[model samples]
Target: MNLAEKIDKILANEVPFLEVAIYYLDFTVYFANLLFPLFLFLSVIWFTSKLANNTEIIAFLSSGVSYYRFLRPYMIGATIVCIGAFFLGMYLAPIASQGFNDFTYKHLKKGKKAYENTNVYRQLNENQYLYVGYFNVTEKTGTNFTLEEFDGPKMVNKISANRIQFNEADSTYTLFKYKERRVGEFGDELISEAKRDTIFDFDLDDLTPVKYIAETLNLNELNDFIAREKEKGSSYISRYEVVRYKRWSLPVSAYILTIIAVAVSSVKRRGGMGVNLAIGIAIGMVFIFFDKIFGTLAEQSDFSPFIATWAPNMVFAVLAIYLLRNAKR
Candidate 1:
């Protein structure tokens, strides 16, 4: 459905076939990797429901196989999936995400800003701090800029400007209405100018990350990126941390969802496979619901990302335990 829509869009836009093919490949891989575990859960339910209907599960337990023993193979399989999912999400999905998002923005959503960070603040180092009221990534400019330097809590110098623009060609800044104050033993010396060009301790591109930048980096790169963003007092730190934590949580969810599927479908019911399938679908939707709700809360508010990332799994784990116990009986 999405492919068809994108195809129509690209055709109307006259986007090239090569770009479309690349987008299609990356688009398919990214979402498939993301939803692989959920699909695996339904597959498990289908297979187990069939086994139960055929009386194979009953025979295994009736012939002195412990329920735990019957579940051993499933657990082993889940472990393999867990590891595979971890590597794919950590290493490969980011590349696919980069391709997918890059194409989306460049062609599908051209001229639109992903988002802008306002009232941005950064601790350049122990001694230097910076602030900007608003920044433009494309223009490489900011308004109401301030940079302050201190030595052991005592102020050294402060610079303020009405507008600042980065000169990428020469690696300097052009400040409008520039003013500087230098704190000295005798007194503070003020320097004022209408316009000035100078260099700073930072680069504009380094200070401001591009949108969807977090989704394009591998694990190590992401960790380092988050550390820098934290020091910079980024308002979207929660969003970045959510992505990082989900990298770890995705694999763990593979096992949790698999166990739930087995427990839910390992018994024959009056309505047969369809009943188990309907139940499985409901459970999957509920899992997605909790995941999205908590994830949004963390991203949009001060909610803890850790709890948001894992809470759904924790809730479903308890449910899995309850269902497994019942199935055992």
Candidate 2:
């Protein structure tokens, strides 16, 4: 289905054939990294179920290999998987995600654009603040733009404009109906102009209010971005924090999910491997559902990102413990 869709898109958009391979490779890496732990969960279930069905596990146990001793190899394997997942999410996945999103937005989005955040506010420095009522990304323009510089508690200079547009060529801005009120030592000075072009200290690219940007940034970039947003009082800070914490939490879930899978599928039953696979699928779906529900809650509300990211694993760890005890018997 995806191949057919990509073919249609390539023909419709006149996308170069060279880009097809690049897009697929980046997308594959991004998607595989994103679901690596989930894949491990299901694979462990399948392999353990097969072993149980063959009674190989029973023979090993009968030969005096303790259940905990049997788990040593699985634990080592899980640690390797966990490290690989961590490395991918920290470094490789971010680059792949950026490429995939860039390709999609450029070729596949087909006139769709990210909606500009409204009521945008930023503190440029300890004493300077900026505001834009609305920004248009396609046009690189904004309405009701204001910049104010404060001296202690009182505002010293207030600059307002009816409209503002950024010039990418020279890294400057053009402001229409510009007015500046300056509080001088002598008295108040007011300057008004039909148009003005000036440069600000801040970068508009850094201030861009685009969604899903956190996912495309590497660990260092994400950390810096979150800190910058926090300093600027960005409303989407919670969303970025959730992404940050999940990078760590998701890799750690490899251990939790592995333990659960082994305990659930290592026992022989009348129905054989089929019954164990059914149970594994159900558990995997529940784990995914909980992660999504809580992660969305953290992004959309005031919920703690730490708890949102880790709660699902914590809940399933108890289930792993219970199942492990039963499997021992």
Candidate 3:
């Protein structure tokens, strides 16, 4: 079997039914996301072409109706679509993403050497970090692990365990068959061994770094995640932050695209829908490319994430307004 087929077999064998449902839900959401914007772009072109072909646009203009007035209904329709997109991105997405990640970790590649010698690590708080040499969420435990709390330049507390169990019931971590060392300001270290459960007030979700790898997270989760990562001063957090904000900002781009598509395609042409669809898709791609490019630049430079994320939308919206006004003239 190939790599993906092998991975699918492992997931099917280990993950729970509910978890699988969430994964499929996430897949659905991603599929919807990929198509919705293109559909909106096409709708704009189609409607505009219909108006032109039916001679309704010409009749409206002759009867003292301006292009601005003609676009009123279309704008309202686009606004409603944008609102739906907003709700999807800001609310339903987070829970679905969390469930999907849980399934992937617990079910996919369970008990298999999926990532050999790869210890997934994450900083939980300032000077506090968790490391898992091998994790199997199905077992709710990780082996060859370390949880450390630092004081300035010195390690103040350290927990070295053979396995750390996730207390999903309490949403915390319990170190099992573990030994812990505590060092004070004077460097006198105290060590203790525990065979039973040792509970620490650390959120296991934070330590499971792969949770962010899922593409379906909503704005709230993304915002909270970025803030948490930023506080820990983790490397590559800025890039994720840019992505988080971009998700929210990018959806409203549909409205701007709608206007531009309407403006460009409203004029009657002998070239027909083929020409209009081509131009609309081309312009739509340019906007998308610019949006992505600016987001990358935001991560690499001093530009604010919000500005970089919204810049393309702002630029396109303004251009649409200008073209729209000219269309009336």
Best by TM-score: 2
What is the total number of backbone clashes in candidate 3?
0
Q: Each model's TM-score?
A: 0.93, 0.94, 0.71
Q: Residues 76-171, candidate 3, lDDT per residue (tens digit)? A: 988888788777766665566555555555566445442223477777777888777877745667788888899778888888888777876766
Every candidate's lDDT = 0.88, 0.88, 0.72
Candidate 3 TM-score versus the reference: 0.71
lDDT per residue, candidate 2, 108-149, as tens digits?
A: 886776544467888777788888988877788888999999
Q: Mark the regions of model 2 whose C-alpha exceeds 4 Å error after superposition.
A: 184-187
Candidate 3 segments whose C-alpha is farther than 4 A from its true place = 1-26, 95-121, 131-145, 152-155, 159-187, 190-198, 213-226, 233-236, 294-304
lDDT value, candidate 2, whole model: 0.88
Error of 1 at 98 (Å): 1.6
Give the higher-lDDT candidate: 1 or 3.
1
